[model samples]
Target: MTGRVGIIGIGQSNFQPRRNDASYPDLVREAVVIAMRDAGLDFDDIQAVVYSLSPDAMVGIGNAERLGVDAVGGRNKRFLRINTGGATGISSVITAWTHVASGACDVVLTAGADKVGECGDSQTVLNKIWDPIYERSLPLGTINMLAMSAVRYAHKYGMTQEDMARVVAKNRRHASKNPHAHLRKETTIEEVMASRMVSWPVKLFDCCPQSSGGCAMVLASERYIKQRGLEAVWITGLAHSSETYYLGDRMGRGFTADHADAHALGASFRKSFRMSGIKDARKEVHVAELYAPFSNTEFHSIEAAGLADIGTSPAMLREGAFALGTNAGAVVNPSGGVLCTNAIAVTAMVRIAEAALQVWGRAGERQVKGARVGIASGNGGDHQFFGTMVVEA
Candidate 1:
């Protein structure tokens, strides 16, 4: 997709452990109304809609998008649903972008919601993502899979317990400023380290809380934005990649064993940068909203996003390099990020929304001053699905 594809509106529902007051469709409506209001348009103006979410098992409903079609005003429009696990949100946005960029539609709405907490035994449900014969018998799910990466990261980079703790503490503090974040209280490194361990090196505090939430965005072509006199953030470049199906494929002998380095992520970032002509990511990128559900994962995510070197994130992190409101470097995860909120389906889309808000100067409390270039990414499957995008003010 080429040309100027602009995000003219963004909205999100309040993130929490549960939203008993509203049904799935209701949540979708809430976000769609807010996004439509922001864009100063109605359903009549939308030419198409892209609804996204994870698998049916996660929400315990087959064809979940059907429930939200009317909510997004997709009754008679060209409506479609997207699924790529955690990457669904961002992937949906990119799909909408292509609608206008390809001259298929002048305006499109992309929205979705997830009630991960409402689902029965979310952990048990996620285990289905693995291959039935090769990987299902191990009793593994999302947390321990990433924990393996954390252990490998620690072994490769010599990252300490305190280093991982710092990542959690920083995001917790940042979440305090984000009104829509699921977890907003400030936390200390001691608090994080003292929390019950879910897996070795991945503590309770390190994990993202399962929340019920919805997010929506309105996208338009350059002519549409100019004609409407609306403020917009441009999608300069976007790319996504998938690793091999089985996690074992990502591991081999030597330093590359365990695939802790996130080589796929690095490849995704490099492809996006090359497409966007981003030669110096460290200097040119001003803010990043990376989808790291765990503390230690942030190190690899940060490095893979092209914000730092493979082994240098921990040291840079200790120096306040990725902290919000930093004077000398990019402010990472100003919206507290996935570490503070995880609504599986909408998680990755929230990253794109937060990045766009920073670029649009609309990220009120958590805005990074003079943010020009922002980046966002999503991780899904066994780190199999990856999405990356660069947004410019």
Candidate 2:
């Protein structure tokens, strides 16, 4: 990892509950074509390929990358698959960055897609992420885990259910500006609160949809960027961290509080900030795309990313601070975020791509004004894996 690496191209398909018009590989190609076109490169230009997804069963295919390699022009080139649960997309981009930064290739493509809706019983598939011997008997899923976190947060900070509804309302309004978002309707706090409660404080509108989509990005070295006269955004710093494997290890044994402090996510952001010379996220980082699948998770992620104090995001939301075009505070999740569209394999990568778009001045409608530096993060494996990146124009 000696040379500078940057993103030269980005592409993503319209996220939806199910893509009946396209097969899995066809869905992958939809993004690949757009990415290649954006970079002004074809399959022949991609020296290496990094593919990612959640699990083989999520898409009902074994070695799923093999089915889409030819579509991405990786059939005769170096190709590899990387998965770390929901963090697979950003991890795949990290793999591509390493390939180009290490001089293994000049141009690398990282692409992945998933149809979580097509998979039967996604919750059952997600339950397998927990340890069978210790944690599997509690009927725990991602929603249940976040529900506990939400309850603890309210107890600790006196955050009301209305506060969580405000978060959803803001994001849904933001999603209305994003054509690629899966859920793009303007919502009110009443709408959010009225939505059926899926898990106590966690209501239906508070959760992200099961989206079927694909996302891909092209990473290139400085030499390639200069050679092609390409407009790119530099990945100034990238870091990832993992918490203890078992939830019991993170929280003391027999602890009923499933609430997460997101300590690992905070640590990952601090490392990325230190590496990129970012002293203050609220000042230096103009925009952020945090991986929060549920509305309540946004508070944890916002604090972990250093965008707000541990218990202050709710107040900030009420004051119009994190709003998309506001000059009041750091704009967050302008792409509507995972709260509006969760493609699992492509969710986190879409965060990175959207940040890059902001830096490159290409994020059209959802773009934040005067956003020179942007940050993105991804969480995976029951919040065990966390990745953060700082990108600049």
Candidate 3:
């Protein structure tokens, strides 16, 4: 890195199943305006833009980012459009960080809007991500594909459905503390168990809602921050990884990574910790905003982040190890996580944004106390693509 990169501002609109009052670009502009205002900067100061948009079909608009260019005032500036499925958000932030870190720009804006709930053929669109001949015939999409992983994780680790239900109950209780969360109603473990099952172990409550919203972040070099005397959170480290397209290739005895444990994700965390000059993430990371869209996935994600070990995560979780206001472990998913509010294209960005907020002491009701170092992650494309980020106060 040529220069230190810091997050100058972050903004997220109220997420819901449908944002009917705002048009797609309207949502984009709303977030940009909030972020810019928070940064005390104008569009003219943004030297580059990274648009975080996923599948255009999700918005029923081809090349949808063309409309976003105007919304974010990319008229004559350098622009990049990123689409890494659910990873698009943080991927855009990381790309924008490069522009500033590489000395190509003093300031950059990463922004996007999503209307996932309004996509009528959502399953068809998701189903296309799989290989047409092999996986598509199984008619697999996001839910069952991840449900399969949940099953493997449960079987390998002896995690009961009630154990997973506790994950849902904890996040929903945390969601009640966040105003922008889509599902804020606190729930009990018994209630989660009663929620209709979608897949065998993945209940309706175990899954995340398809939300619609927008989010934006402003990044600047240390030089720019010093020049402006802006309060900011520094991005200490960032990394990305990709898994094999065939989920089967990632599973079983001979594979490099087991589908049950997701060892590759652990490796990604190690790479990020190396970049951050951290030797022990379990001690150094004070907060974590993991992208676990399903309840069972949260356990493995915590392990992958080094917050807990594989078989020990369920036990640690039951001991109130990863809950809000707990001193035991990095307060996991203090923003209710994707389980409570998932706006596909911007969900991962929200993860980093919330992490930054915690580090900045700006995460109001859902803030983790004394979070000096925080980590965020993004998952995309059948658990094949991953991104990890480390942010600091």
Candidate 4:
């Protein structure tokens, strides 16, 4: 763990509903070129490649990573593909970090991309990730599953639909400054409230849009960093955990499984904080890019990350603790988060990239002042998978 691995360069495409102009490989290449250029390296300088993508069933292509090897500059180098539902992006980065930290390679390229819109009705495909028998018959999709969480949170905390709308408004406002975000228009609470409802408690605007894009990052060891004299953000610690595949399995266990999720995340955060040598996460960490495809999930993430006690995130939000430039707390999702830009497969990686940029002093207008420590998280598989990472200047 002491062998340092840092992100020297990061690049992403302009996230949008569709990208008819570029093939999937072209999208990957766009981010790769920028990342390599930013790192001041050519394809030959990379020792290995770690590519991330969701199921081939969603993209209508089998062995998709094999097709992308050339574009990712992995034609002759060691290549590995990762698939962990939505957690693929962040998990891929963690894998690459290990390759460099273990000295198996000095530099590795990590990238992910998705074309959910191009595949037609991504929801239908996502539905297939669930178990084929008992759980698949409830007409339950991602929206319905999240709706259940929204209802639970609302009843538990006395939250209203308008509160969720406020979250959308705030994230969209943040997205307006992000050129690569999928939805960049500023939104109002009323506008979000008025949006069509996908489920009882979840509205259309409350849900993340189907996005198509790619992102790439160049990771190097401490030796590589010092040799190149590159401004870098070190990956101090990383962890991932997965839950049971079926919701009923989790429920019969008396919501203990959800607590297990919290425990796993808590362990990850504790390890990362210790590794980074930070005593107070809320005080030492200046920025956070959390993956919340739904507004209420943001509250869940706040509690899971140990940033707030259970049932207190809404109060924190009302107090403006999570807002940008607030002295009381860290800035959460300054890149509009998943609420503003959800690239399906690459959403988590985007969060990692955004957090890295903030720590590297390259976030432009959205950068947090004196952002020395940052955190990024990814949730996947019907909220069953979670990954957290800590980065430091």
Computed on alpha carbons, the lDDT of every model, listed in order, comes to: 0.89, 0.87, 0.90, 0.82
Best-to-worst lDDT order: 3, 1, 2, 4
TM-score-better candidate, 1 vs 4 = 1
| Count of steric clashes across candidates, in order | 0, 0, 0, 0
Q: Which regions of candidate 2 deviate over 4 angstroms?
A: 253-258
Model 4 misplaced regions, further than 4 Å: 259-263
Write down the TM-score of every candidate: 0.97, 0.96, 0.98, 0.96
Q: Write the per-residue lDDT of candidate 4 for residues 279-387, one digit (tens) a residue.
A: 8777778888988888877877777676777778788887777777788878889899999887776888898999999998889878888888889888778777778
Ranking by TM-score: 3, 1, 2, 4
The model with the greatest TM-score is 3
lDDT value, candidate 3, whole model: 0.90
Poorest 10 consecutive residues by lDDT, candidate 3: 257-266
Evaluation by lDDT, superior candidate among 1 and 2? 1
Worst 10 residues of 1 by lDDT: 250-259
What local lDDT does model 4 show for residue 189? 83
